[model samples]
Target: MAIVLRYVDSLDFVKERFIGIVHVKDTSSLTLRNAINEVLTSNKLSFSQIRGQGYDGASNMRGEFNGLKALILQENDTAFYVHCFAHQLQLVVVAVVKKYDGVSDFFEQISLVVNVVCASCKRKDLLREQARERVQKGLCSGDLETGRGLNQVTTLVRAGETRWGSHFNTLISLMKLFVDVLVVLDFVKEEGGSLANRQQASGILAYFKSYEFVFYLHTMYDILHLTGTLSKQLQRKDLDILEAASMVRGTMEALQSFRNIGFAIILPKICNLQNIGIDLVKQAPQLLEYMAALSPCDSFAQFDKSKLLKLGKLYKYDFDDSDMIDLEGQLGIFYHSCIKDERFTSLKGISDLSRLMVSTGKHRDRKCRKMFSKLKLLKTDLRNKIGDEFLNDALLCNVETEALTKVEDEKVMERFEKMYAQRGQI
Candidate 1:
């Protein structure tokens, strides 16, 4: 499969207090090297500009002596490549859960079951039809159990620690409705194979009782709160989404004053997690150093795929395929809302403007220019309402421009000239 590099702009909860996209691609080593060099050379950003580098536990990105991190660090020794804490935590979760054959089997069975449920329009229609009938007949009808696709599974799994508990209901509720699923499974068996992986199914059901499972369940809430929306309450971090940025600044200043005393208090709390030998937890002092070394080039390379898969594995404990399915449905709803909802006009315009500003070189076509013009006009009105910091963030939305090759650079120039001439003709 051809994998395109996806760039996501997000906040670094532990360091830098700035939002930037971590770039990752799905190309070969040669392609990756060329792509990284192209981004660095074309953008005129030095290795010094990088404040942090984060990658999954992958040979390509994180190889100790010769991988992407090493190559970048050679260019700028100060570049602090931190293993993505989220990715590492995901790995730990997977390693912990896989101790029981049942958990692994559960994932495999759920995957198959989900496939059976959503196999086709015919199958989906049958499920809905049966569900409706069950409801009407006074039979207990519950959530439609299905397998989690990659995206759906990831969302629920990686959903911050606090949200996982809410999802527990979402999972067991599906299990309660499993009998209804067996009804659908009968249709699947008639069409093809049996719905349950009977051999592994019982073991998975048994594994749920393991102490590891219980401990994982206990930590899910704390983990969710830390990773998800609850971490926003860490007023000292000064993340943007927190209400009243100025007020947070004051709180941060107060924290700075108590740094020695605070560390005396907080070090013990941090050490608890570090005792397990998680590097990020141990390297708390390097937070600023890591931030100082992050680079724009890191934003365009292929992200660690295995790490994402690992996260999916960890997430499987609390979620199944239905959660993923619902996420997709929700995404579809959000997408349609962006396209059709009148209330989203201002938000949509801002999103478009942000995209236009980030577009670079030949990629910058008529649409971008038009959007920029409109954005420039809009800014005059929005400036007073939105603070400079917020406005700057909107402008910097595409902080890393399109990764262009030397050949692509020439093409971009040629295309720009043609478009420029065409505009002149008009």
Candidate 2:
């Protein structure tokens, strides 16, 4: 059990410090709480000093009645609990991949292939040699580019059960060394050290060379790569909650867009590879609809009115019930009223900082004044440099002039006749 603490330094920067890990006999709430208390006591800290706690969404840790969080809160009610974002992302990827039996089978076979190929030093050397030959041949034919970081030799990377990004790297490495892997698998099947080994290798090689496996390999590579990028961004220490919420929403939209049109984009490439027909495209697995609806809602509660409206539109598909729609309508009205209030808009820049300081309630010192003065100077400089013309241009750059207004939506269908006519040309 790794323990860490997050705190704000004198400079007003948030920092995480590593606390000593504790080994407990069991994961019960009492045991976990005792372990934590031991760590705190050894470090000369008190339970009352804890402002927040973050852990994975485990029953023993996050349970409402008898979890570590509850036990800690009993002592110090101010220690709020937050679920770890990185762990949540890993769970999301795991759930999405396991939604399809074929995807689960693909990962299982890939793991077996990695274990078989890298079981011995001789096989490892053979793989490296084969990969080197392939790179040389491709370079000579002008099919591969030569650069500092391009076309470097790659080794098999085994995917971990916990690390979501590892699967993306493993799939990418497999695709890069596809021919070498096939050659090694063929060798193992034809002449193995034992009969049982040869049989296993033969079965795996057959599955590895199949067109279905290839389809999933490419499909998951695209999907996992995007999620992996978002996961990395969320894991950054300096990431703000607002930015993380925006990234989560953007990723969901990208996934939804891919679900709607990715088959068309990937089909041509797959067909060119193995002369497959359109039937394969029709048989391709669709992304789960619920996956596109997943977003970090807790962080989004801090969003401004404009951002909230954009979020509502993005998640409008999930609000299938009247109750949800009504709730969202009320939320929109609340944010709209807040936006109309001049004081709220004026104080928006420092609201986040103010909230943070209020939570700690430690800004009654000189350090707080220094931080405030720096922010004031920054605001003054930004106001002086950014003119009305610049603001107007920034807002107008991406505005769609052809968009229909509220009046058109309320009127008859004929109001869009001209717009539909213009759209037909493209």
lDDT scores of the candidates, listed in order: 0.41, 0.65
Give each model a TM-score: 0.40, 0.62
Quality of model 1 by C-alpha lDDT: 0.41
* Model 2 regions lying over 4 Å from their true place: 9-12, 22-27, 38-49, 76-78, 268-426
lDDT of 1 by residue, 1-426 (tens): 111122224221122222222233664444565566665566575555554566557787788787878877776665667564335434554563355454444444444555555666776677666655655555334333434541121111111222233434434434445555656666555544444534333443444455544333333333333332322343232332212222334433443443334324433333222222121112223332222221112231222333333333334433367655544444344334434544334432222333433442211221110223434754685475865556544544423232222246567667777765565522
Q: Compose the digit string of candidate 2's lDDT tens values, residues 1-426.
A: 546677776546565554434567888889989888887898899888886787777889998989899999888765767566667778766775676677788899999989988988888888999999988999999999998999777789999999879999999888888889888888888888999879878998789768878787877787887788888887876766545655776777676666656756776553332211111111111111221222223332344444433434433333335635554556555445545544344432223444444454533421110222332443365576655444333333223122223335435455555556655522
Top TM-score: which candidate number?
2
RMSD of 1: 20.9
Q: Please give the lDDT score for candidate 2.
A: 0.65
